[model samples]
Target chain A: MSFDITAVVNIMGLAAVAVFAISGALDAARQKMDILGFMLIGTATGIGGGTLRDVLLGNVPVFWIREPVWILICLVASAVTYFIAPKLASRSRTLIWMDAVGLALFAVVGTEIALEFGTSSLIAICMGVMTATFGGIARDVLCGSNLTLMNEELYITTALAGSVVYLLLNSFNLPNSYDLIGGFLVAFILRALAIQFHLKLPNPHRKD
Target chain B: MSFDITAVVNIMGLAAVAVFAISGALDAARQKMDILGFMLIGTATGIGGGTLRDVLLGNVPVFWIREPVWILICLVASAVTYFIAPKLASRSRTLIWMDAVGLALFAVVGTEIALEFGTSSLIAICMGVMTATFGGIARDVLCGSNLTLMNEELYITTALAGSVVYLLLNSFNLPNSYDLIGGFLVAFILRALAIQFHLKLPNPHRKD
Candidate 1:
């Protein structure tokens, strides 16, 4: 019951890239940034995590370096968002839900890539969490906001949950589709519920 | 003529950490940030480049993980700057000079580290530029300014010059101290001269 990890990774990567690009455009729109700013944010969000991963892996000709389509996608996404954002401004809730989907997909894909490179489970999980959250962190920083690092958010936790689930399923030689679906479902559900219920982890520095 | 790359690297790293911490503190003082903000900015500036390098290298425990002193140094530096900054506020030129020193030191150190890790010469030069500039980029993002990346200053060019010089010296099997001194001198001299002459690179998009 071996899985073709590469194919699944590619699909997940493309999905994550598109979702993050849109998210970046939305963030820029919220900040009232100019068109160039929006495009920059979108490109950064789309390629930032993959670039980090490739650099760590010592993979030359980083992802976007080889395939320029990712840049085109982000540019188009930013342009489209700029013109259509007014109509979609009221759909922040929907965008949040889609972002959860993207987060889950990216976490699993990142973990798989790390595992493919022979990283330990702990390192894989770290990679997964990094891949899932770094784009958002970059967007927040660029937009002049303190990242979720200082806050009690379930962001990394959700990614960790997906990573763990994916690892466990793969350990038992589960079907590839099952592993992907199962991992994404767990993360997406947890994230959606957390946002819906306003669930947040208790800050360690806060008085109980 | 063999060289002790490790020793030179260590000195450059320490110098980078110190100068960047000071720069961060000065920036925080300019913004009148609170103590926590000062410490955060200082520590980020001090360790941010190394952290990025480590993440890219897939190095475990990152640079600051083993060294608690770096954090202490940044904290102390921030405290010192907070108290002394008001008196030094009139000397903005001095602060800028210190930042240039930090940039030179970081560029040399980062290039050496990347070369030691077996990266190509081009990659090493990129690393040097990243190491020298990333801290300021992070600071600017946090401070809600776009001046760092958008400016046509000699910042990145100086770092690139230092890195290329270091690589060439190493290729010639020169002494480690010679390369270090040479690299730092090149960067510092170029940067200082640029500032003194008010020289700037032509913006690619600017009309003549």
Candidate 2:
């Protein structure tokens, strides 16, 4: 946990939260929500997964509540997005790609954090997937999406794949840098490819 | 707490979870979601509030995860509803009233639990309102309701009022049974009256 290493991780984490918050804000705008709703969903999407992880692990007061800066960042980012979403619609696809980067970063970092908390690797992997996907899930749910019926994306799949890859790397006692890069690439690329090719998992509700 | 009292509380808690599960399943049926969706939302709504409560309080592993029977009950109740939802439509109003009962019970119990956990009175009260409303919120969100725009009746208002009353009684060093009964009556009566009269809070977003 050298200062420089921690600094890099922290910066990446902030970026992930910011992008997620912006996306959440965009979602709120699409739903024609009030400003308060925008900020609420933004904050929820940014910190929700980690919050759930910490809570399940008995780490109370929650990270955002304890450290006000994260909350501030999420709210600020969301407000900014609310103002910019209309102008960004045509370019929204670019934003989703950035979200993929955040998704990948969060999946690996979330798992590592859980593992550091002394949870079993299995739980850590679950944490990774949840941390990566739960924020969007919460946002979608709040936006009134019949989530089960709309379950046609590779969203969770990308997260699980990255988490498994990260864990596999860790099993060999590889350098932290290696696992970090390898896992991020796997997740980011997988998600990016999915989005670009309009990849979708089969929806059980849909008749073939 | 005495064993007999604890037993009473546990039974009440189980009933609350069961009714919430049934309501959640019914919501899924309304949306035509698959059986998997029904169980997912059912379990989520049933335990969501307690999970959120424990996380904020730093109590980990969550109540349902620790005592899995709660999850079992929620899933089983939901499964039953999946088969009976169509027939239950005419009787569904009765079920909503049952849900009101659960809401009242959870509001007081949630407050008491938070107080037992040594949270500040204000935080405990917030927990009570959340524990009562969040389950329904999750279900509505999963069922694709525009919640804020649909804010009506005495839903959260009753929970907040009852939690305040319960906490006030506790401040006087009243017996737990008395607080429980008083709070439940206050919440249930307020909610039932609202439903019977078709009362609604002003919809701020409504256009003239």
The global C-alpha lDDT for each of the candidates, from Candidate 1 onward, is 0.74, 0.80
**Which residue pairs show collisions in model 1?**
none
Residue A179, model 1: Cα distance from true site in angstroms = 6.5
Per-residue lDDT tens digits for candidate 2, residues A1-208, read 4446567767888988998898888888888888888899988989888887777767667788888888899999988887777886778777787788888988998888777877667667767977887787788777765462235347767787888899899888987877877888898898888887877654343364
- For model 1 the TM-score comes to 0.59
Across A49-97, the per-residue lDDT of candidate 1 in tens digits comes to 7677777766545555345565567667776777777766678777677
Off by over 4 Å in 2: A1-98, A118-130, A137-152, A157-208, B1-3, B25-44, B51-94, B117-127, B138-208
What are the candidates' individual DockQ scores?
0.09, 0.23
* Each candidate: chain B TM-score: 0.88, 0.91
Reference-based TM-score, model 2: 0.61
TM-score of predicted chain A against the true chain A, for each candidate: 0.86, 0.89
Count the clashes in each prediction: 0, 1
Please state the error at residue A120 of candidate 1 in Å: 14
The local lDDT score (0 to 100) that residue B172 gets in candidate 1 is 82
Model 1 regions lying over 4 Å from their true place: A1-47, A50-108, A114-133, A136-140, A143-208, B1-16, B64-69, B147-149, B205-208
